[model samples]
Target: MSPQTDDVALSTTAERKVVVQSAGAQPDKDWVIVTRGLKREYDMGGEIVRALQGVDLAIRKNEYVAIMGPSGSGKSTLMNLIGCLDTPNGGEYWLSGQLVSTMKDDELARVRNKEIGFVFQTFNLLPRATALHNVELPLVYAGVGSAERKERAMEALTKVQLGDRAMHRPNELSGGQRQRVAIARALVNRPAILLADEPTGNLDSTTSEEIMRVFETLANTGQTVIMVTHEPDIAAHARRVVVLRDGKIASDERNQKVTSSLGL
Candidate 1:
């Protein structure tokens, strides 16, 4: 797995595993995400497919990390685990201090709704709903009052620079504006982490760059973001890049260019 050229700031393997190696205990509050020997598998008929093989990772609060890999490299599986959308077959996962790898499906659902904000390639907006309504859906599901939901939804829209388009339907917005709305919706809950899966996959190059700038702004403002992308150019926008190969991490290093640009 070749990442775009750069000098790695992490000089030793030990440094990379410092937090990951702390097994059998709750991770420090300094780490917003941690995985100790994380593993996931699926059964295809009678055959077993191991998607993740003892993956150990640590991400602190406010860190912007990009996960990169080939199609079968298990990045998606790892994302699902980190997002609490799926439980692993083996090992421990801690997100915002909760050990979620052992949580039941119902419990996992609750944590996922409260802790992970997801932005997808498809935007996933309701075609008939206004941008404000789409952003309000999460709060609505959380049983928030209409007044409060509207206020928070507007705030989220403003964060993504979409407040002026709040009343517009998805069809009334450009591709970039729609994605911005999706980003606004994801931020409405102020989740512990924002997990984006190929967020630029559907957009043109210019629009993708626009969205990446939004992510950069959010990360600079202390929001933790985890983006899974295949393109090196896209991953380069992140301050750190983690490349996965054959279900394991092949390299995890800082992207000096982006890190320096962000002054992080």
Candidate 2:
């Protein structure tokens, strides 16, 4: 697939309008994820630590974006909010046309299950389960039947080119293979977005490139992937990079030269 760019310019005015819009209104279909004036704070030792301070972001469907920043730049907080793992104290978060920021915990949990697929740095697979079984876990949680779950899991594994290792456990797989299995598990549910947090953090340089190629393939296939990483080289794998600083967006730009998996 040919490389693409995020043509939507950053408009604070538009973001503010989306923020002030009446709650429960569906976002425009073009935007798969939107955050307006998103804010989050933590109480630390009787002092308040403002992690995210009114962040406004918009991501369209099939966008391969990287959220990058130094430590304490609020990228992690932004990721948590985007992933629906945490809610912003202020502002509206819309995911796949739904206003998810206002959702309750249980509702958010359901939304996470139905709308988001997560790949963590640790490759959080069940140590005892085979790659196929690990991939099947999400469908199981969704109450899918046995046969269909297995079939979908296998197909997802096949997408990552790990079909032959479906029966292998995490302990039996290499670091890259385990991450691929995790990616397969994330894709099994066909979620609206694949959210990866420091996906290649645990791998060596060679293995990291291997995992990156899998992500590259997924992005080429129209997957909306948002990866949170501090490493510039890893972030370069994404077509667009958004850098956060001092709890706000410092820079958002397209990478003119996206890195290829083949190291061209």
Candidate 3:
């Protein structure tokens, strides 16, 4: 695949994202994400289902964090809120110091397109689109011009070492390669946070490790990453782990930084 082709691919609307990172964008400053008294509820046949109840979280810029919990524990709901895919029934959410919860639909959509990049459990690439086009989807929606958009997209693909497979479609690639392409798509927009939900759910152990390595490289480059996974092995790759239970934070702890500590 030519680098030029990789750069010009179309946009894929995964979750919402907005661009909050700039050189003067508080490089060393902490706190890229913050939430207070967060809550989300749903009505089912006139019954209330509380997905999250009074959750509070603070994440710093460039931090690698993971949210872990069993099904029905609100992990996915929290991820959606964080990813800006959905709004909460009650609470405050701040992204790069902007109040996301208070924004209207158009404002929220802009924030999501520019500030956050999302990776799904299924990869979510368009079946008919080539890998490069899939990665370029976000840039297209942001009103980026063709030439510049292609350049940025290609750069992102290169970051994940997928520059050579830009022309291949999802069906033509292996599971690991497909996920790598998805990761490239997530990074293409250079969002403030790369939000991933069960990114390794469909991959085998070796492939999963390969995917995590891409994440590690991203973190090393000062990318803020927040991933949701239930597997302990996958969570171990994160710098810190936060466990949710019964719609609340059960435990939050710093995992060993083996990557940085051992220079892996």
Off by over 4 Å in 1: 1-16, 260-264
For all predicted structures, in order, the TM-scores are 0.92, 0.90, 0.86
Candidate 3: residue 120 Cα off by (Å): 0.9
Model 1 lDDT per residue over 20-106, tens place: 887878887767888999999999999999999999998877778999999999999999899888899999999998899999988
Model 2 C-alpha lDDT per residue in residues 149-171, reported as the tens digit of each score: 99999999999989999999999
Largest TM-score belongs to which candidate?
1
Predictions in order: lDDT: 0.88, 0.87, 0.81
Pairs with steric clashes in candidate 2 = none
lDDT of each residue in 1-264, candidate 3, tens digit only? 223321221111121111222212332235677777789998999999999997777777777889999999999999989988889999778788887877888888888889999888899999999998998899998999989888888888888888898889999999999998888888888899999999999999999999999888787677889999999999988877889998999987667554355444
Using lDDT, give the best candidate's number. Answer: 1
- Candidate 1 — number of clashing residue pairs? 0
Q: State the local distance difference test value for candidate 2.
A: 0.87
